[model samples]
Target chain A: MNKMKELSVNHLLGIKYISEEDIQLIFETADHFKEVINRPIKKVPSLRDVTIANLFFENSTRTRLSFELAEKRLSADVVNFSAASSSVKKGETLVDTVNNILSMKVDLVVMRHPNPGAGIFLSKNVNASIVNAGDGAHEHPTQALLDAFSIREKLGDVAGKKVVIVGDILHSRVALSNIFALQKLGASVKVCGPLTLMPKHIAHLGVEVEPNLDRALAWCDVANMLRVQNERMDNSYFPSTREYVQQYGLNLERLQKLNKEITIMHPGPINRGVEITSDVADSNQAIILNQVENGVAIRMAVLYLLASKIKNYD
Target chain B: MSQKQLLNSSEMTVTLQRLACQLVENHTTFQNSVLIGLQPRGVALAERLVEILKNDYDLTDVEFGKLDITFYRDDFRRSGKVLEANTTEIPFVVDGKRVIFIDDVLYTGRSINSALTALQSFGRPLEVELLCLIDRRFSRHLPIQPDYVGKHVDVINEEKVKVNWSEDNKENSVILIDE
Candidate 1:
């Protein structure tokens, strides 16, 4: 038997702390919680007295809902702060926001913000465990975890599997998340879009960058489509959405060109006919809904693990 | 294994021969007998028993198979269905064969429960019996028990048992621990 490579998943600054062993642990922990979630009680006493605050400075539906569900499933007391109503609108600093929240005796903080490294900065200012929900375009660790879990669960193993991520690579925290995750899970990752939308010097990020969508689509066992992220694109990521879709959109023809066995995945709120066609988006191979189910389980795993780590030492 | 036998290498070997003899006598209904090991601990114990049985008797064909219950686990997702499960294949048709499910320790029986759930995937066995290196008393969470035992001991609530084996020199022992 071949030796299994370990995964490490950490909740700190930078992507350095998460190893493959930690990824496996999170997936396993998430898998374990599926049963706990199915129960009539719908909760575990793992973090009975623990208090977790969902500190969102960005708008989201899947991430926010899943984090709250994950916390509730673990029996943790959850507090939420919508960024629009927070005192930060009153000229408060990030450190002051964190300090004020920490003073409230929260055990963990799950934050989403517009600027990259916002979660890292908040982590430095607090004693509570910090989970980066989505931090600008840098990375969404939880989303990455869920993506990897879905890929591994569906395709058996992601190691050495060819995976191509299409659409807005520059503005997507989902893209950054999938790249880190697929790479960690041993999948050969590729990112494809127009030259402008594709990351500059992208090969240095340990992924192949392709401008031709057809070649990238045929080369991968799994193709992850990223939404154009129009809301976050302050300036033109490319010349125009119509030209971008014409060149790179996953239409029925491109879908047929792909290997029938190659799975279609998207961390969705999909842009129909923009990144992918409706037919391809709703195809048999698309595991988008599965990703949503796994997201809650994955978040549940993150909470259980972080809580256990806290309890293990203290 | 009993505390004395676990500590005594010579005594451990004698009890092994005795357990093999008992298996041979009781499993007389089948022409061929196969030992299927559950993943992790069961695989090790099955490998151990095959050697002990072959050394004591002049058997021509004593078969061993590694059964990966990762896919068949009741709490597969929760148990974290790992990509690599040891492998669940008994090569021959297991129909009507007396099969021994070997494991290192018997606790809540969830592993055996998972193993039994897995065994149904292959051809049905005529009979299935449990064998363990250690029988942890008062932990019958599932409705499973070992037919053969090296030793039985009482375990406290806060205490756990760890069985360590050295494959290089073929040395195995037991350790009772608290965590």
Candidate 2:
């Protein structure tokens, strides 16, 4: 057989920066890593000589841990830098901080920042490869990749699948990334949430906006519930948590009434009784943990593939 | 690129049969021996060997798997090009088993080195052996040699070895390309 092509970009800034072939390549590589991670040793000496720095300007438990675990699994040395403890607290510029870290000969930088284009900005200035964990609401490319991967694993293919991303579209980096990735791979996407929480021109991105939770759930093959970011909400997106749940929350009753078997997905920190009920979240159809499990493999593939472009790492 | 055929289908078949008979002579039913093919190219030879061992030689109990060493390459960063990974599917345990690493060509033995490191994820084997279709002599950068080699060819740095299988290109041939 012919060799599978690798992603062309040096930096995994966003799903928008990659092509369909790149996405296919990533999924294929992730398949291998997933199998490797399940093995007894659960480690590959792919990046043994490479050094990586995880620079998260924003607080993130899952993404940070996932990237670190992935880096470790690939046998790459990793140094983690978080804003709460780093010089960023001392008001150091992003460039200066990363440059100082790069002076230690870090071959790659996996960053998560509150600013939308922080990763893109660093990729332009930094000498190392950049993997965007989550850059504001712009894109969490790895999350999107893992999400698609989980979908592919569960559904066989992302192509021709009806994926409705329910709840909080406006402030969701996952929604945007998924939209780009799923569409690129031939999945018809829909965004369903309260009107206030929905982003304008989302339909222009080729995703349908179905505000009716029942209608969206009944029409889709999968329902991806997004967390209501109470921390990020500056204004009232909806009346109250109870009201939102009553309208948009996916409960056992709502799920059973749908009559169609739709896979449930949550990016985690699931608002248990809010966006998705405990029963629904814990259902066999819910691949939330699989998404988390596939996250390491996907991140490993991303790091390993991107780090392949780094020079002279004997 | 200029191509010169080294081994055609019939010669390739005879060599593979010889390798299989030799393996049977030593393994004697493949009770504790597992065959691992290096991914992409090596799998073709490994698949053929497994088929010959199972169908022709009547040894149906041999275990076979594919191992990809894309991530284990020492020169990945030096290449400046991203190498896509192939599947590594070793479903059985390798602990205390005689493992034979199969590949289409062995030049620098870097892939075999990577395979050795990669095989650890499965388990520690009783012993590991390298089997290659073509062994390009004097090109190895490491102190490694194949235990079973079908053909040994002397080639300079500018030359390339191409192994094609019937499954891939409707023919089986080993060719040398001068660039």
Candidate 3:
């Protein structure tokens, strides 16, 4: 048998930093993990001796739990730290806090911070491999991977597919990561939202901006609905939540108007009746739940590949 | 490097017939017995044995599956290259049934150890056995010995055994290559 290849980069800071071959390799490895998770015994002993640290300087539910479960399923010892409960509350710096954790001999770090480029900063100052869970509104690499994997599972391939991301493009790490990942994999991307919520010069990123949601929905094979980040906005980007729903909400009536059925996706903690309705989220055309399930497998692939690069000090 | 042929095509056919007969002598009708082939190389050997068992002996109820042990290996970080994974297909239940692990060669006894750990994911077997085409002597790394062997040869640490099959677009033979 031929020898397997390793990933090009050691740290997964963002999708923009990795190559197209890295994404394909990750998707192939995720295919194997997807099969393993369905077996009677879901655990593997590949990372039995490795230790991982999850440092979350921001709040999250799905990303944290998904990374933890992926670590446990691979038989790796995990240590978790949150800013609310850790020394960050006492005014500790990012590099100081990570160096303190590195003193415990952690081999890999999965981190989420409120500031942009925090993972990039930690990767340069730390000795261990870093996986970016989320860095401010910059990028969520694993979420984008799982979203692409979910699309591959539903549509058989992501190449030549039209994907339109709707709502809150200005303050979404998911949107940025997904744009980078999708374009790298040969898919055309479009962003649909209000002018205020859309970023300035987003077209420079090579994505088309569609002001009307209905035209964006009719012109795509997949629709990714992003939640309105009310917490990130200092002032109201829209007049009201009711008005936002009236213009951009994905309801059954709007879906029925489209001639073709498009795959629906949403990264979790969705606001029902805001970006998407409850019925549309639970409909057959929606792959929101499948995205959650694939999240674990995608995370396992990332951890396993990174752990293979950890060399012995002695 | 120099190479020496150990077994030719005619010899391999006879040896496969004998191994099939031995399997039949032990597992009659194969009602509760399953044949598992280790992935990448062992799968070809297992498939050939299963064909002889069905075509010649008229035993059509034999349960067979393929297992991959990449994730269960012990030398993950010790090696220089990354380990690639293969497909594992086990459609039948192995609970309280006999399992016979089939492989092409038994050398160092480490791959079998990994296979043993990988088998637990399916279920517990009543008993387990091993069958191999070639057994390299003095390789008792884990105290594992094949129950049925086609041929035994004394090999050194610097030599490698290469088994070529028709399924891989090569002549059916086994050769020892000096490194």
Instruction: Give TM-scores of the second chain, every candidate.
Output: 0.84, 0.96, 0.97
Model 3 ranges off by over 4 Å = B168-170
* lDDT-better candidate, 1 vs 2: 2
The most accurate candidate by lDDT is 3
Better of 2 and 3 by lDDT: 3
Which residue pairs in model 2 clash with each other? Answer: none
TM-score, prediction 3: 0.98
TM-score of each: 0.67, 0.94, 0.98
lDDT of 3 by residue, A228-279 (tens): 9889989889999999999999999999999999999999899998999999
Give all candidates' CA lDDT scores.
Answer: 0.75, 0.90, 0.93
Compare the candidates by DockQ and give the number of the best one.
Answer: 3
* Two-chain complex of model 1, DockQ on C-alpha atoms against the true structure: 0.06
Q: What docking grade applies to model 3?
A: medium
Residue B8 lDDT (model 3): 89
Q: Write candidate 2's Cα lDDT for A115-134 as tens digits.
A: 99999999999898999989
Any residue pairs clashing in model 3, and if so which? none
**Ten-residue segment with the worst summed lDDT in candidate 1 chain A?**
A1-10
Q: Lowest-scoring 10 consecutive residues by lDDT in candidate 3 chain A?
A: A305-314
